[model samples]
Target: MSFRVGNAFSDPRVTMRQPQPVVLIRGTLNPAHVSAFYATAFPELASWLNLNRIPVSGPPVTLSHIASSTMMEVAAAYPVTVKVPTTQRITMGTLPGGPVASLIVQGSHEYLADGYDHLRAWLGENGYGPGPVSWASYIRLPDEHGDQRACVTELSWPIA
Candidate 1:
């Protein structure tokens, strides 16, 4: 399917989201491995949930800690209906959602820095201050072994 490139909500707005629970795997990855990482991580998470009879609650979310041009420390997660026990490589936690500034970045994951910058700028322009954290929830991942240009990434920043 073709993905369009533009703002997530067209007109940016501050919205409140309820807390969500997720099953996540934290790891370090370079830009080159982003696609591969998600490709491998999601299915593995899904299989684990399926094996344990857990139900999915929301879309996949990638919580980035430090994303530089060289490396990124990220938590790949899928929201779950109930609390799930932690595994050797995976853990469960709640994403405390409150007021947020959000947008959509349609393209490769490598350009996400620009997207984040854009959100920060918007927050500043509108007199909204950023909170301690931010995250990217993937709406559409790139095709397996396909071009990254068609990817659709959603970015959200906690704001006050």
Candidate 2:
């Protein structure tokens, strides 16, 4: 399916989101291993959810805890209607609710850095500082052929 790009990034906004229950897998990964990491994590998460008969509530999200040139500490998560007991590598937790600076970007995942940069600038200009965690909800992912031109990601940073 094809998705159209939107102009949502033109005006970044701060909105309140309710705390959400999610099932996730956390890992420390090199930049080069990010794709492979998610490729494995998502399916495993899905399988566990499916086996447990849990319901998914929204798109997949990546919670970024720490990022640097060499590595990133992140969690790949899926919102769920109900929290489940932790199993093996999968953990259940709630995404914190609060004022979040958000922007939607359309294009490759490579553009996400630019989107974050934009949000950082906007936060500085608007008297806001980033909170402890940031996340990206993947609205529309790349197709099987791995073309990312049409990917849509909502970039969000909790504000302090």
Candidate 3:
């Protein structure tokens, strides 16, 4: 699928954020299965939250803990207004708040690698080292919108 990258990004900036509460389900799966994982995980998370009467504070987000060619450890999460009890599968946690190099990318999932490459290059050029975690907040999802190619994601990489 064809999607625009740099042109859609807001200028990358370093911003300080406060730790936000979240509920998530994490898994280690093959790289090719990540999309399918999100598809299942997000709906389950939403249903769990609704059942618990917890309000979602922001858009659905995915946290990348470890990534490699074969497999990756990732979490599908929703920002919650308050901390909630954890379930057998879902856990309550926080999106660590700190200095992050952040940018907005509008495109299809196929173009995400290119967007991340640009972010990494920018971090290198700007003399910043990326921290352990990185994440993408799905502002507008392809399935939710009329056009499957139209999506907006906010990418954040913690910087040291």
TM, every model: 0.75, 0.86, 0.88
Worst 10 residues of 2 by lDDT: 1-10
Of the candidates numbered 1 and 2, which has the greater TM-score value? 2
Q: What is the lDDT of residue 109 in candidate 1?
A: 79
Candidate 1 residues 1-160, lDDT tens each? 2223553233356779888888988778886786688778878888888898988877789776555669887777988888788889989866767888887777787777877887888899999987665788877777898777777777888886
lDDT of 2: 0.85
89: Cα error in model 1, Å? 2.5
Cα-lDDT of candidate 1: 0.77
Q: In model 2, which regions exceed 4 Å deviation?
A: 1-8, 67-70
Minimum summed lDDT over a 10-residue window in model 3 is located at 1-10
lDDT of 3 by residue, 31-93 (tens): 788889988999999998899899998999999866676889999999988768987999987
**Model 3: per-residue Cα lDDT at residue 57:** 89
Candidate 1 segments whose C-alpha is farther than 4 A from its true place:
1-11, 28-40, 67-73
| Candidate ranking (TM-score, best to worst) | 3, 2, 1
Please list the C-alpha lDDT of all candidates, in the order they appear: 0.77, 0.85, 0.84
- Residue-level error in angstroms, candidate 3, position 47: 0.8
